[model samples]
Target: MTQHSDVVVIGGGQSGLAAGYHLRRLGIEHVILDAQAAPGGAWQHTWDSLQLFSPAAYSSLPGRFMPAQEGEVYPDAAHVVSYLADYEKRYELPVQRGAWVSAVHRDGPYLRVETSSGDWRARAVVSATGTWTRPFLPAVPGRRDFTGRQLHTVQYRSPAEFTGQRVIVVGGGNSGAQIAADLTGTAELTWVTQRLPRYLADDIDGRALFDAATARRRALDVGRTDTGGVASLGDIVAVPPVRAARDAGLLCAKPMFTRLTATGVEWADGARAEADVVIWCTGFRPALAPFAALRLRGARGHIATDGTRAVDEPRLHLLGYGDWTGPASATLIGIGRPARDAARQIRDLLG
Candidate 1:
C-alpha cells in the first residue's frame, strides 16, 4: 500500500518549504519528502564559520524573515538551519524526514516515488532538490594513490582540524577561495582553479545581488517561453568572499590540472604543486539520479528546464536552476518564483 497526496515535493530545503507553504495557502494538500533527518539540506553539512554572503533580508523565505543579530555581516550556516527548522515548525509543514527518494517514475496518470522507507503516489512532483546535493570533484589521475587525507569542501568543517598541515585547495569559486583564506594563518595553503575565471565585483552583497538577479530572472521568464538552452550566470558576485580572498592574496586565477601524481598535481603548463592534503573546492551539482527517466541536457548532467517547466517532461518542473547571466537564479531568492509558478501549474493540473 502506498500513501497518496495531491502533490509530493521531493526536497525539504527552503525551496521545498516555500512550495509546501504556497500549496497550503492555495488549499492544496501536499507532502514533502526529504533525504535528510531535518530541513536545511546543504547548510547542515557546510563548513563551520560559514555565513551567507547575502544578508538576512534577501535570504528570508516567503512569509518569515531570517532573524539576525545587529551589525552581523550575514547569517551563519547554523543560523540558516535554525531559521529553516523554525519555518518548518511554524507552518507545521507536512515533511517526512529520512525518507530518501530512490526513484521517481510515471505510473499511469500519477507519479510513483520510491523511497528507502516505502512508496508514494502524487499527482504532481516538484524537484526543489537544489544543485548542491552532490559535490563535483574531478577525477584526478593519482587521487587514489595519495596516502594523505583528502576531502571535499563539503566534508570540511573548520581549519582547526588541519592545523600545521600543507593543504592544497582546488577550484576558484567562493568556497575554494574562502577555504583557502580560512586555512592561511593556520596552515600552508595553495589555491588552484580551472580556466574561464569568473571574478566578483568589489561592491555587492547578497541583498543587492538578490534584487538584481530577481529582476533579471523575472524579465527573462516573461520574455522567453523556451529557456532550455539559455545559460545565465546569476549574481554570484559579492564583495565579502572575493574581497576577503583578494586581501589575503589567495586567489588562484589559472586553469585546472592536467594530471595528478602520487606526490602532487601537474598543471597544464607542466608545473607541479605538492601538498599534504588536497581539498577539492570544486562546486556541486543537482542530485537528479532519482529522476533518471527525465533526460537532462548538457554533458555536465544538469537538467534542462524552461523557466518553470522541464524541457523533456512538461508535467515536471525544476526550481533553483542556475539561469544564464541574470540575478541569483540558483540562490534561495532565485528559487521562489519558479516554485510558485510550478505549484500554480500543478494546482491547475490537479483541478
Candidate 2:
C-alpha cells in the first residue's frame, strides 16, 4: 500500500528536523524519512574528533537549544548526535529511520517518494539529503597509479589508526586544518592546498559568521544590492584545539601538489614526496540522487531554486543545499528561518 502525507521530509538531518519543527507548529501532517539507522544524520558519520566551530549556545536547532555540556565549550560530534536524538524524542516528530529515499517523481498532482521500505505520495516535499555522502576529490594526473591509501574526510575515523605513518592532508578549508591538527600527535603530517588557508580571528566563531551572513542576506532580500558579501564560514575558526595547533606551529600548510605518483604526491617542480596515506578534505556535493528522476539538476549538478523553493517544481523545496537555498542554510543556526518559511508555504498550499 502507498502511504500518503501532507508533507514528506526526505532527510532527518539538521535541515529536515528544523523543517519538521516548523511544520509541527503549523499543525501540518508530515513525516521525516531518514536514511540513517539512527537519528544523528551526517553527524553520526563525522570523524570521531570532530567539534562544532561554534559554542553550544550559538549552535542549535529550532524549538529547543543545544545545551552546553560541563567543561565542553564546543560540542563534539558525538555530543551533537546525542542532542539530535534527544530533540527528536522531546518533540515527538514522526520520523522513519532506515528509510532510504530512492527516487522522487511527479505523480499527477503529487510527488511520489519511493524509498527502501515503501512509497509515499506527498502534497509537498522538502529535500534535505545534505552533502556528506557525496565526497569530492580533485582530479590529478596519475591518481590511479598511486598505491598509497587515499580517502575523503568522510571515511576518516581517528588519527590513532595512522599513528607514525606519513600522511598528506589536502585542502585549505576548516576540515583539512582540523583533521591535520588531529593528526599531529599521531602521523607524520603534511598539509597541501591549492592556496594558502585563511583563518578567522580568534574572537570569531561560527556564531558570528552566521550572524553576518544573515544580515547580508536580509539586506539583499530587501532589494538593497550593497550587502558586502560576508566572509566564508569555511575559513578556519580558531577554536581551542585549532588555536593550540596554530600557536604550536602545527597548523602550517603547503601549496597544492601537481600529481599523485606511485609512492606519493609530486609538486609542480617535479619534487616527489613519499606518503602512506592521503586524506582529501576537498568537501562534498549535495546528495540528492533520489531526485535524479526529476532531472531538475542543472549542468552544475545543482537545482535551480527561488530561495528554498524549487524553481521548476513548485511543490518541491530544497533545503540544506547551502547558500542557494538560504543564507548559511547548511549550518545549524542558519536553517531555521528558511524552514519556517518553507513550512508556511506548504501550509498555505495545503489549505
Candidate 3:
C-alpha cells in the first residue's frame, strides 16, 4: 500500500531530525526515513578516535542543546550517537529506521518516495541523505596497480591494525591530520598533501568557524565585501589530538606523490617511500542517487538550490550538502536554519 505524509525527509541524521523538529513545531505531519539501522547517520561510521572540534554544548539541533559528555570536552562518535537517539525519542519524531530510499520522482501534484520498506507520497520531499556513503577516492595514476592495501577514511577505525607498517595518508584536511596523529608511535606514518597544510589558530574552533561563516553569509547577503568565512582562516582546525600531533612535529606533510609503484608511492622530485598501506583521507560527495530520476543536478554535480529548495523542482529541497544549500548546513549547529526554512517553505507550498 502507498502511504502518505505532509513531508518525507529522506535522511534521519542531524539535518533530517532538524527538519522533523521544525515541522512538528509548526504542526506539520511528516515522517523521517533513514537507511541506517539505527540513529547517528554518518557519525556512526566515523573512526573511533574522531572528536568534534566543538564542545558538546556548541553542537546541537534546533530545539534541544546537546548535553556535555560526562568526562570529555569534545564528544566522541558514540556520545553523538547517544545524543541523536535520545533526541529522536524525546521529540517523538516519526523515524522509520532501515527504510532505505531507492528513488524519488514527481507524481503529479505530489512526490513519490520509493523506499525498501514501502512507498510514500508526500506533498514535499526533503533530501538530506548527507555525503558519507559516497567516499571520493581521486584518480591518482597507478592507484589501481599498487599492490599494497588502500582504504578511504570511512573504512578506517583505529591504528591497531597498522602497527609496524609504512603508511601514507593523503589529503590536507582534518581527517588526514587526525588519522596521521592517531598512527603516531604505531605506523611509520607519512602525510601527503597537494600543498602545505594550513592550520587555524589554536584559539579557533568550530564555534569561531560557525560565527565567521554566519558573518560571511550576512555580509554577502547585503552586497558588502566578501569576508572569507572559514576558507580564509585555514584548512584544518587544531583539535586536541591534532594539535598535539602538530606541536610534536608529527603532522609534517610532504608534497603529493606523482604515481604509485607496485609497493609504494613516488613523489614529484624522485623521492620514493615504500609503504604497506595507503589511506585516502580525501572526502565525500553528496549521496544524491535517490534524486537521480529527477535529473536535477547541474554541471557542477550538485543540485542548484535557493535556500535549500531546489530551483527547478520547487517540491524538492536539498539540505545538509554544504554551503551551496545554506551557509553551514552540513554541521550540526548550522543545519537548523536551513532545515527550518525548508519546513516553512513546505508548509507554505502545501497550504
lDDT of each: 0.75, 0.89, 0.92
lDDT of 1 by residue, 49-146 (tens): 77787778778777788787466767788888988999999999999999989888888888888998899988888887876768887887878877
| Candidate 3 ranges beyond 4 A from true positions | none
**lDDT over C-alpha atoms for residue 158 of model 3:** 98
Per-residue alpha-carbon lDDT of candidate 3 for residues 1-351, written as tens digits (9 for 90 to 100): 999998999999999999999999999999999999888889998999999989998999988899999889899999999999999999999999999999998999999999998899999999999999999999999999899999999999999999999999999998998999999989999999988999999988899988888889889889999999989999998999999989988888999999999999998788899999999999999999999999998976899888899999999998899888888889999999999999899989988
Taking all chains together, the TM-score of candidate 2 against the true structure is: 0.97
Clashes of each: 9, 0, 0
Candidate 3 residue-pair clash tally: 0
Comparison by TM-score, 1 against 3, better one: 3
Expressed as tens digits, the lDDT of each residue in 1-351 for candidate 2 is: 899999999999889999999999989999999989899989999998889978898889998989997788889999999989998889998999999899999999899999999999999999989999899988888889999999999999999999999999998888898899899978999999888878888888888888878878888889887455446544678778878988999878888998998999999888878999999999898898999898899966899988888889989998987778898899898899899999988888888
Best by lDDT: 3
Per-model TM against the reference: 0.88, 0.97, 0.98
What is the lDDT for 67 in model 3? 94
Sort by lDDT, top down from the best: 3, 2, 1
